[model samples]
Target: MPKSLHRRLLEKGWSEDEIERTMQMMYSDEKREKHAHFVSATHPVIYWVGLVVAIVGNLLVAVTLIPFLMILNSTQLYVILGIVGFVFGSMFNLIIKDIEHVDQTHHIVAGVFIPAIALITVYIMVSVANRFNEVINNPNPHNAIVLSAVYLITFSAPYFVYKIKDFVWERKQKASEGA
Candidate 1:
């Protein structure tokens, strides 16, 4: 079995008092090990590729659905888009780590908000494109440009929020340690 946290800290020459204080402030070794394992098991390349596929695939579907929206009833169109959004969002949630927090808030967002946002985003894009006569009739060079930009922004939003939260938490931890 692995050594306990206290034993490892002692091996590292941490003072007894400091070790006790740190132990009180942090999770137990088992919990830390579990978290570490989870982090280590994640693959950045696979995650990024999955996210790209989710974003671009959903966006392409959205573009394709634009002309059909005029023929289909609003309810039908929404249902189809909702299904597409749910699939892509679930794919995204599965690919990304740390999105499923202990409180289950992340899970809720992954299951609900991601899909809703995706649906809304696609609707807006299609609406705007139709208004401006930029309907995506067939694949064009501009399709790549537009899809890349939109997908980049959509995929980056959640990560941006996570990074901001991490930065704030780190700053707070530093402040607390200094104090």
Candidate 2:
């Protein structure tokens, strides 16, 4: 069975009165039910748009970095894989949200998806750039290795941003609860 409206609201951080009113509306109006269905269908369009933006951004980053990298012939492979992964992540996020029970796992799934795609994209682009830099100056493998490590750290930028946003929202929820 579907979860009760009260439970869904509590999970969503809605006020008690808001929950009651929503539940009442759900029961009393067929129109409200239709609207809910519409919202449910369209809500993740925003996420899809975000994913598309991410894909485009990652592709741009890749294209920009490719020419600059003077490194070994293998840099192209990694860059291509990075682009593919981001595209897959975007499409996966869009498709998964359409399936039933997606609401139960949406946030965690999205949280993981965004960072994974962002990290892979960043790593590939930075790796190529680092190799390119090293190839022009020193033929040393050590520079490439160091660049990889630094690039991995940079790849985590999105995760930190996501965590901060989540923390702020949680704090707001607690403050609202206290008031």
Name the lDDT value of residue 131 in candidate 2.
73
Q: Global CA lDDT of candidate 1, please?
A: 0.58
Cα error, candidate 2, residue 34 (Å): 1.7
Candidate 1 error regions (>4 Å): 1-42, 97-120, 129-179
The CA lDDT of each predicted structure is 0.58, 0.58
Model 1 C-alpha RMSD vs. true structure (Å) is 13.2
Tens digit of per-residue lDDT, candidate 1, span 1-179: 99998999999999999998898668777778988978755644444455457657766776776666545554564456556544554457455544344325544544454445555656576555555444545331123234334444554455556557879999999999999
For candidate 1, the per-residue lDDT at 46 reads 47
lDDT of 1 at 160: 53
User: Tens digit of lDDT per residue, candidate 2, span 1-179?
Assistant: 99976888799999998888877776777877788898878757755666567557656765665554444444554455445544545444444444324364665665566556655665676566667667677452323443343443444443455457769999999999999
Cα error, residue 107 of model 1, in Å, equals 11
Winner by TM-score: 2
What is candidate 2's TM-score against the reference? 0.44
